[model samples]
Target: MQACRSAGLARGLGAVTLPWLWGSCRRSLSLVCAGSAPRAGDWRPSAGLGSRARRLSLSAATIVNSAPRPLQPYLRLMRLDKPIGTWLLYLPCTWSISLAAEPGCFPDWYMLSLFGTGAVLMRGAGCTINDMWDRDYDKKVARTANRPIAAGDISTLQSFVFLGGQLTLALGVLLCLNYYSIALGASSLLLVITYPLMKRITYWPQLVLGLTFNWGALLGWSAIKGSCDPSVCLPLYFSGIMWTLIYDTIYAHQDKRDDALIGLKSTALRFSENTKQWLSGFSLAMLGALGLVGVTCEQTLPYYTALAAVGAHLTRQIHTLDIHRPEDCWDKFASNRTLGLILFLGIVLGNLWKEKKTEETKKTIGSRLEN
Candidate 1:
């Protein structure tokens, strides 16, 4: 009879609370259904979960929450629950590494592995740094209010300590590269450390983010070739920055209304009703620079084909984008990962095609000489 009463109470609560809060109420409900009502002091508010319940749908959030309690806040601080930023940062590295591969070969697996590790660490460090800087402003914004630092789950001193550890690990990764690459990679820290402040001063924070995020375009080439080939790497790097502008601008749109309320600046607010036009301009710039990369690198038909596909993909994103709807903006922003992969596939296949054509020519020459 007690269990039946508890189950009835649980159902009533579920009917009233939001979907996300239902999980929090589960523990209390479970105890009740087990025939023992939680004592008055035993009941905990949903906020006791500290924003974890709000993000239950995210797979990474699920993984983070499964860890030891002490580690969960730090993990959240690093934005591990959001892996898309890491992918965006790493994709540019893969592009340069693939392009720098010896003709007819895939990118160096060891270098790719090394850079992949660096991307995760550095991207996490970047997030930690950003959160630390933005925690105050974040608290004022609904979308960001639940962030670990903003929600008071982690202290500034604790976040600073965490940032140090992340940077130290990232430095260890950088030391594994050649001296020039090491120096080049280390220089990017300035951008990483300062980028979070850009929103407070300029509408072009996405531009600063582009400059920071695409440093990998230059670093990847130097790692593989011992130094960057300006003709090739420069164009690739430029293309990456332009691509960043397009996606990050779309990402910025999600917070623009809040940003306006709080006096923060972003391209989303700068372009306003003209955002699609600005995105189109950035897309054209990105495509043009990519074409230059293909020319400088002497990429084959497959590469250009991939380039064409990227243009179409960008076109679709801009055409269908609804800047007023944050969900649509995020979907468009996430789709750029696919865009990056398409170009990477092109670079790999293009090299193989070039190698095949070279071998065919050699065979023909050998046959003529024998005749």
Candidate 2:
């Protein structure tokens, strides 16, 4: 009777244990499924898994926040972030117009409008070409590593397409000019094509850039006067070269580290420690050259006064510059736009004033002869 009672108890206990064990196994499998599944809000942390997950989420958020914004990529490629290039390219053209108009009349609205459009199209084209050529090298430089071409945001073929579009717009603008202006415009292609390669072979790519950028000075003179006279255009062009050197040196400071790592050469890297002194010399030279041009052209008193404003602007740029800070360098470089505008207005007002004086002189002389 006792043995039979003991066997019944053992059987009952086994029966109860089996279902409990199976239920726990099922619960474990469910937890594993929940953890591995891709559905939203289905995370099942095992033991200490919750903290690790929080860390991962925070890291992902940080990366997304820190990544370069999408719009910046486009702006970087176009160099819209750096407006100095535009000013450098545009100012020389403005000088040419002012100088060309010196002997005749002030720059008309039509000429100014043409120059404005040309500056936009040509600067875009130049940047695109520069990016396409520097794509491989850009990938190696930290500052340029994430640029459109280097980061694979735009392919070589896409760059070529963009180049085509820019050229088309520029060509359309060129067609609006006279035959001589058109010819002078076409002649710039050689310089444009050769400019990107200059950094690879020479430290004086700034000089090459001066030649390329200052072509506008020549074009402006030719567009207005329909002929090339060195006496009128040379001073403006030479002044442009010096201006390019000064501003471009500032620009180069932004890339000094990346350039050094990539084995690229620039005046900034070449004159790293003494950049300020060199810049001072260049600025003084530019001012002197411009002064000579103003005197030679006999620009009106207002024009000279405007040039004095430019001198003040240059003084401010030099005084506040911290070449070690790229942002400061860029700001100083961009301030040149104001300089360009002041000079442009000066040239226009000067010519207009001269014309008014000439008319008054003629009237007085005629009255005297009549008397």
Candidate 3:
């Protein structure tokens, strides 16, 4: 009699409990489903998907974002909204300019200004080309799926035309320089053209990016000197490449899962578990190259000091890197801007040191003559 009552009580409890549990699950499922309901003519990616969705704004607050709706597409196509890539592209040029200068002298500020303009134009053009080449592939990567071309916000032909305009402006910047620099600058196009394809074929696309992006190091030296000696410019170029390797690897980590899903490859995948080790190697290579660059350029102790500062910054990044977290990787990648500025300032200080030494030498010579 007791057993029968206990069973009856348990059945009554389940009868009451099942409906509530079912209702709760329905509500939870509906909440998850609400964000992805189909809409007519909607091509925008779901807000809940992907690392970029979590980390970056759905739309960047750029000049393009602020523009009239009709004109917004073109500016975004140029990526005027995000300036980090522009800085990364331009810094190598300044590095070369600073290093190529005679001891104790200012870098070519005029040329720096010109390279800045050129970097803006050329980076836009490169983005255009990358989009055009990867539009189909881009639509598959959640982070890039809404890229103007990939989202049908900009057509391929229109992108090509915009690319032409950017190239024309870049050419104008090139004309402001000498023929040697023009020739050197023109060679970079080959790298830009091939870069989008690199990810398809090799896990080392970032390596190609290192070579392509750092061409400015070579161009900067040639712009001033009309030619580059292997010894003088090579170290800067190599260091820039190593720097790219470090940062781009971090960037690749942000999209590693997506890349894997879609048959793409990156260093992020290749060094998945051992990322810090790889970053350590790249960082060492970059710093070692900078040290060699200092030796080759006859930079003083301050140059190495500045290089040490860069190393410390990279060390912190590597130490703090949470490779699995998209936000952290993006932050580390963005931190390269600070790294670039530090190195630039270091070069300036090293030159000041050289200038002081020159002044001391002149004073010693004058005193001896007077005696």
Candidate 4:
């Protein structure tokens, strides 16, 4: 959406400004030279820096500098840095829209707009809740040690405030939908709230995430039709879930060591040695379910061709994945968003072609009848 583009720009600006502000503050602190460590009563306070201005500045600067770049923390909080999570969140809604409009034209502009809004808000809310719960553990993890919460840029109270703001936005988006869709959307909050704790008690937290993220698919269909046909939406929902499993497993590779040390459980740690095999199986399952969804919806050949592209995308992820390297793992995980969009565009095009063919056929039959 153009709005998403604009939002991205705004987010980018915020990203740039946050670091600049922090750096400036740090520079000011660095300029302050003390002849020696201050005596307890000799310290003078200025602004909010307090009596420990030097120590506070140094700590603040180190924390801010070490914090995963402002934009990154925001993105990670929204799971934007790892876009596969967003795609996995978005595709279900896409699948629901396509399926509900099956054998006809594509979903209207309103449906797409609503789903887009919901995706962004819900994704953000989910991340805020997750980071809130994981702040303590995040401080212990190498990659996450500098997160906003862990590094103290934001306090627990501030995190809850941010979370409330995100949820309010999400709720506003949900209210734009029908009663059924709203209810369905509201129902997902429980899963979202508990998702962060899933890893603490279960090795299959990724599975919980799949279920939580894919709820939008059902909401999409329910929004349009007012009720779900399990036969239609279930397979697509499950497919999205499988896709999440595959990608998030790759994601977990980046934190397996840290997770183990923190006593956190994940499929990444569960399938450490045999990650490739498990990823392959999950990838195949995702493709197969997607194929079933296409067939069930009677999608045109173009849609299948697009799905073939998705298959290739997944194949590339699998082949190029280096579970040993965290960067490679993140790259593979983030690539799923492209795959999701490819499939979504394919379905939309297929619907368009089907509509054009139907219209042409109707005109031909009318002319023959008149003749």
State every prediction's TM-score relative to the real structure.
0.84, 0.75, 0.82, 0.76
TM-score of 2: 0.75
Best by lDDT: 1
lDDT of 1: 0.79
The runs of at least 3 residues in candidate 3 whose Cα sits more than 4 Å from the true structure, single-residue gaps closed, are 1-60, 368-371
Q: Write the per-residue lDDT of candidate 3 for residues 126-206, one digit (tens) a residue.
A: 889989998988899888898899999988788888899989988988987889888888988999889989999999999
Worst 10 contiguous positions by lDDT, candidate 1: 25-34
- The lDDT values for all models are 0.79, 0.69, 0.76, 0.71
lDDT of 2 by residue, 317-370 (tens): 877888899878866766665677677778767776786777788999999999
Instruction: Arrange candidates by lDDT, descending.
Output: 1, 3, 4, 2
Please name the candidate that would achieve the greatest TM-score relative to the true structure: 1
Q: Model 4 — which ten-residue stretch has the worst lDDT?
A: 24-33
Tell me the deviation in Å of residue 246 in model 3. Answer: 0.6
Query: lDDT at 361 for candidate 2?
Result: 85
- Candidate 1 per-residue lDDT, tens place, 163-235, comes to 9998998899899899999999999999999999999999999999999999999999999789989898888
Collision pairs in model 3: none
What CA RMSD would you report for each candidate? 15.7, 27.6, 21.9, 13.0
The segments of candidate 4 whose C-alpha lies over 4 angstroms from its true place after superposition are 1-84, 102-104, 363-371
In candidate 2, how many Å is residue 238 off?
0.4
